[model samples]
Target: MEFTCISCGNPLSESDLELSINLGSAASMEEDVDLSGDESPPFALDAIDDSETMNFYSTMCTNEPMAESSTEAMPLCERCFESLAGSIIHDIQRTTRETGRYNEAIDQLSTVTPPPPPDLTALELEESQAMAEFQSVQAELHKLRRTLAEVRAEAEKTTADTEERWRAMNEAQREADAACEAARLHAAVSTNLTAMLASLREDATLALFPIVDCGTHATICGITLSSNDWAETGAALGVVAFLISVLQKKLDIFGQFTVSPQGPQSTIAIERQGKSTQVYPLHMARPTKKGAVQLGMACCCLLHTIAEVYVAQFPDDDAVSFERDGHSVDLDDRSESAESRRPIDAINGLSVVPEPRGAPSERWDLSWREALLCLGRVCRSTATLDPG
Candidate 1:
């Protein structure tokens, strides 16, 4: 099936040429007097016309290019359109041929402006009105050309602005991702209470995954630790590593007790006899002078120290605070951080706010898919936390 040329109402087909020749030599014989010329210019002027004489008049009206012959209408084969649409070879050939023919016609007409001029008062008036109409149409055409150029310029500018906006957006997203990654790295080494606060804003997982949070783990925020996810829970991708302290929890919290050659002894207790403090005593034979008590006590003490460093939660001190050793600790206080005081300006300069539930958070919406693609590049993960 083929489509018709919308502009010319003509079927587009592969034809070398479709020349139109207006056989008007008869009309030229006497200006519509009669198609009667005996000499006939030594060539056919009635039954046939000179090719040059015919083609000149025909070009005026018939050469109206088919508007649908536009470059857009690729209905014409590629090589054909390239050949016909102002091909350099065709242009040179056409220019030489048409120029020679036109010059010949002009020379012939120059030698023959015969007879006295006829009074053409009414004809002159009609010609004057037609000239005025032509000038108005020409002015409108010029205006249309100017308007088209303006529209094209505006379109180009809009395209450029859109590209620049996209570039800027990508840069901002990269900075944000780098900052979030920094915060993620820092939070992993922080305490449990800080972990809870940071986990409350855990949307970073979504951007890194297609559907599931990390493709391997299920919802891990508040689930059992010793279940199937003993693997994932121990891994850093899920949550703060709280379960690793299970062994530490089993060890008593009181400072370890010691057994001397003279029964069990707590040097710390004797030192703080007046003050209120508790202690734990691990049963063992009198030191055996082998420092076994010292060794066990040291191991227990080291485990507790590690737990305090990584697993201990911040005190929710719901009481008033006082000074000891001239130190200002949160004995009991109900105030926020100084940054929180000016919450609006906190800049959150870098934060790891996780994806919101019901709807995609303001952090997720983007202008296009590539925006997030660029962000996914910065999402950092480590193998040491694999728990494998």
Candidate 2:
């Protein structure tokens, strides 16, 4: 057989039925196994050569009880042998029908053999031509059936390949989705639980409130800059001053050098230029909503001078504000209320506008801390040191 049936995977053999019966149905076990791990073939079978006649014969096979199953004079096992016999009979009958049809087709073709050339009748010639044409049409029909079968096989293979790819893609997507979900859940748990963790021993407690540093308010960075520590605020401020001299640049030439603050309790430090002075308030008293990076040199200088006065007595938190939006009288025109230029009355036991700076800041060689100590000796009472 040139091909195997896809459904049954069996051989449609060349053996003729007439010869099959002559052999008396000798069943030989071919011992085939399906390596593809699918179901077994439906039947066991055998083949015989044609002898032009058909008949059947059978001989029972039995093992004598005394004999061992060895290679000495033995017949096939009955179960296997019987199964083979049945399949052979079926094959014979099937082939008989097929062969009969094949022969009739041949007989029909042989009936009108091409007549000897030139039989003078035109009608006879036409009949012979018609037969050739009919034969050609039958040949083409057979070819078409074979081509259609091949096309169907190819289409089925493509469909199976596409389905396999689609399944693999879906599996990959599911794996990715699972991984992303795991990461998201992990992040949520960390965010929710981390607050319960304790802070380190050296850490300082602060509200972490967003605050602004201004003339009145001091910040940690500002304190560090002014502490006479390495990169001391006094020196840094001087360096900034030197750069300002060289660059001759201004943030806003017409604008005041003050910055707005956004919080009520921010802290700040001050260091003056050309003078060694460092000071810090206990807390910053401005909000952070309106804040800016002050020109360190000028701001530090202004703050140091003011701090020298307030270091003895300070102003109430809201001592000075430039805004006069609600007033029609201008302090500039001197048409404002008589009290506009004057300091308000006492606040929290502190007086206002203590005094103008004594003589600009003295150029001192002592550290700011040392300077504070000398001043403290000159004036006792923390209350007097802070006039606020």
Candidate 3:
């Protein structure tokens, strides 16, 4: 007869049928004995489906037979048979583990005693005391906060008062500084006015000298001039040269000609094209024609420089000018005429010609007096004094 699985209705292989027949034989051998009489069932039927293989195993282990006509209905495919066997083995292992755990729990219960319950009264008292301390601490914290607020308010008031005092002090300091500055300015103005008055007095005194005396009877530094007295004339000329040098320095005049005064031995330097030519001994023991001519030329050059300075200061005024024979005394004038003859002939009566012999001292004194008169006019104009 053909055999098939009762669970899935699939034909069973020969090896499956052979394994089932061996299990049946083993079940028959144990039919007379009770395999599960003294202990619980090893496999749990609830753990697997109630399939035909399960039912077959259950009946065989209990020594129960199926109906005669349905004896072969217990056949199963290999897959269903393996699944059912695995479920039965898993249920057996789980039962063994549960039994072991129950045995361990029983052994521990017999060896150990249970602990007593806690005391509720002492615990309740401790909780109440802890709550009371917390309340006290909270009250102290509130009191400290109030004290801190009061201290902060006092500090703000003190700071405001300090600021007011500082502002007042600063304002006073500013007023004092302003007063000092005003006093300093007033003192400075007073000093400047005093200095100006003194300078005016000195200039007034200097204007009274006889150096600028342009009359027919001229005197030099209180000494009268004579035609024959060479010594007196020479000394007068030295004084004139010294005065001219002083005037040049006072006016801050600088140019091609520079004069250095040493009574009777004064010198004059003429610079042209960066070359300097010096003439010395403006006053000699016995004046020669050549010496007189050179002295005259030097005086003309000095006068020319002074004239230029005066013109610069008073560009519009033409009252006082240095001229000789109707021509201005210009040292650079190189034309052939009376203009060229200067500065040698710029001063009148200085040269002693052979045809009409004249006293050289007298001529020198006249020329120098005229030059000094022109210088006095310049000084007065610069000082804002009366030229007369």
| Superposed Cα deviation of residue 377, candidate 3 (Å) | 54
**What value does the lDDT take at residue 102 in candidate 3?**
100
Q: Give the Cα lDDT of each candidate.
A: 0.35, 0.36, 0.51
Global CA lDDT computed for model 2: 0.36
Question: What is the TM-score of candidate 2?
Answer: 0.20
Which runs in model 3 stand beyond 4 Å of their true positions? Answer: 2-73, 76-90, 102-116, 182-388
Q: Write the per-residue lDDT of candidate 3 for residues 58-149, one digit (tens) a residue.
A: 55432345432233334656787678677778866787699899999999999997788878998899989999999999999999999999
- Tens-digit lDDT track for model 1 on 1-388? 6543323445555441221111122224324444466433322223323445434323322343322121122233333334333443454457659989999999999988699777799789999999999999999999999999999999999999999999899988999999999898777757666766455444222112111121112222333112232243233223322322222243222122222221232212111224543333322233332233222322222222222222223232122222212342231232566422221111121312233356333232222122112222211111112222
Per lDDT, the best of the predicted structures is: 3
Clashes of 1: 5
In Å, residue 68's CA in model 3 sits off its true spot by: 15
Segments of candidate 1 deviating more than 4 angstroms: 1-119, 189-388
How do the residues 109-172 of candidate 2 rate in per-residue lDDT, one tens digit apiece? 9897786877568977898899999999999999998999999888899888888888888888
Lowest summed lDDT over 10 consecutive residues: which window, candidate 2?
251-260
RMSD of each: 39.8, 31.6, 23.0
| Reference-based lDDT, residue 350, model 3 | 33
Model 3 quality (TM-score): 0.33
Alpha carbon lDDT at 80, candidate 3:
77
